[model samples]
Target: MTTFRESLARVASRRSFLAVSGLIATAMCRPALAQDAGTPSASGWAMTDGRGNTISLPTRPERVVAFSPVAAALWELGVRPVGVFGPFRQEDGSPDPQIGEVDLDAVVSIGDWEEFDLERLIALDPDLLVGLSLPDVPNTLWYVPEDASATVEAIVPTFGVTPSDRGHLGLIEDIESLAAALAADLDAPGIVATRNEFTAAEAELRDLLAEAEGLTALVISASPDEIYVANPSWFGDLRFFLAAGLPIIEPETEERWEILSWEQAAKYQADLILVDNRGGGVPFPVLDPIGTWQSLPAVQAGQVGPWHAVAPYGRRAFSNIVRELTEIIRQTDASVVA
Candidate 1:
């Protein structure tokens, strides 16, 4: 598995090349139409994606190969995908936390990060390939290598859901709608219960935030050399938090992240610090030796928590995050930064 830093570097390099070579225009040559409501037709099931590509199959797709996060979201609604790709597994051979409660033993892993096993994916005989669409990259599926995207799409109908510029709740609703189109019972007791739990969690978080006046948080991913401050507007979870009355520090950048040197780590004084907890990031403990990091107010006050920027999108997954964040806010001292 590639480290998060390494993966970001690779993506940056590829994106730069794509920009220079005018491949973005070529990628947008695919069919574009208005978004559909994933309605079922007499001939088959037809659904449009975030990229405005409607995929029609002879029947409702039964064999689905999806990105790990997408699979995890569908799993919560009782839709079991046949195969999963992307960062679904960790280097230790354990299921990645981003996958939520997926049964790894039951599904085939088609690939990891930017690499895919074309042969294994083809063998799955998937009727649909689902993944998040990169907002900055036209028609590009997240985690699907740009070089192999054509080959992969040629094998099956592809569905993309974009996560950027929307709140997490909105994204969850989109996934729920997709699950319904896949024939999952939206009124299932488990699904309904989880939705109710998520609603309650949201309320609790809002109430807690109301009391923690002036409290602010900074979201970041750390590497050995630099700190990446996430742009809240580009992240569903952070956008959701901001909309829910949490004062998340928004970096001054159009890109998804603001890169900063170690010395500039204190550029934002936040009452609480949320460090990225994904497999690709360096753990917070590993930064204890860095004097600049240690000097941060939140770090000195011990008001730091883990941030799951790319966790599986669903009621259950998000509810857990909200509840955990509520507790962290409850324990944090709002005066830490001041």
Candidate 2:
């Protein structure tokens, strides 16, 4: 995942806003509305997380707190919870906010690292507490003293980040697993419709990339320290590389992201550079400095631009991200003569 050397800041302007709700929130475009108590799922030990964390839940849990964004996929899959660790805008410039839009009023706030109030979490009386099994960096990282990983397993029934090999996995896997927990199938009409839209958008991106001269592209952030770019493995806009038949610039590395310098970045025979706005690659703002350098030929040619971060697996905005990424690819690729 991308790491920001400097403190991360959210851009306030609409120039960097993109969302595609799956119509699940026709009720949410407004303000708060009371929702009836959600029905619970059956009794049993459901599944295991990425790190092999197993949860033996007695009954469908009514109170739930997700420590990872991928867990949002659970809500879409019919696993509604009382709390969520979501992507939110902090009011006081704190690394994380106390609570954001993810909470449905009925849900109590069980925050992430910056705002993890273990006391409040215990008071909330959660029947099931789920956590990310892996230390996928910013996605989910909690301190476990010695053998912290094992300690976490002992404390709460933590699960791993979204699975990678599963076709329905990635960020989206959260929805399916969550559905099983909530006893609600979210993929029927609303989720399925959004998925179809994304499929079409991805197809368009592939057609545009394949038909046009393959632009040798480099991935970077606004800053030098951050340069982990995405391919098919990392979801979000990067999916286009695979769906569009575009070739990726793969470097030898086992980590989620790698830091690359301008000279090294310049060496890439790519026609474009797509910045990872998510924490997985380079922090978003750092892309500005890296993109405007006159010494670099790609910047001079205006082949550098930022890809807005979106949960490729998010149930609320997955389709929206696809549309935005497609537009970027189309507009950016327009400069290249076929």
Task: Write down the TM-score of every candidate.
Answer: 0.89, 0.68
Clashing pairs in 1: 4-280
Judge candidate 1 at residue 41 and give its lDDT: 75
Candidate 2 lDDT score relative to the true structure? 0.45
| Sliding window of 10 residues with minimal summed lDDT for model 2 | 20-29
lDDT of 1 by residue, 1-338 (tens): 65565544642453532221110122122233233545567787888776777778888899999888789999999999999987777788777877779999989999875568999988999989988775467778777888988998898889987543345666677778888888899999999999899989999998888888889899887777888887776566776787788999989886767889999988999999998765644386568888999999999999889887567877898899899999999999999876
Clashes of each: 1, 22
TM-score of model 1 relative to the true fold? Answer: 0.89
Residue lDDT tens for model 2, 67-103: 5444455654555566554433343433221122243
Compare the candidates by lDDT and give the number of the best one: 1
- TM-score of structure candidate 2: 0.68
User: Model 2 residue 167 lDDT?
Assistant: 26
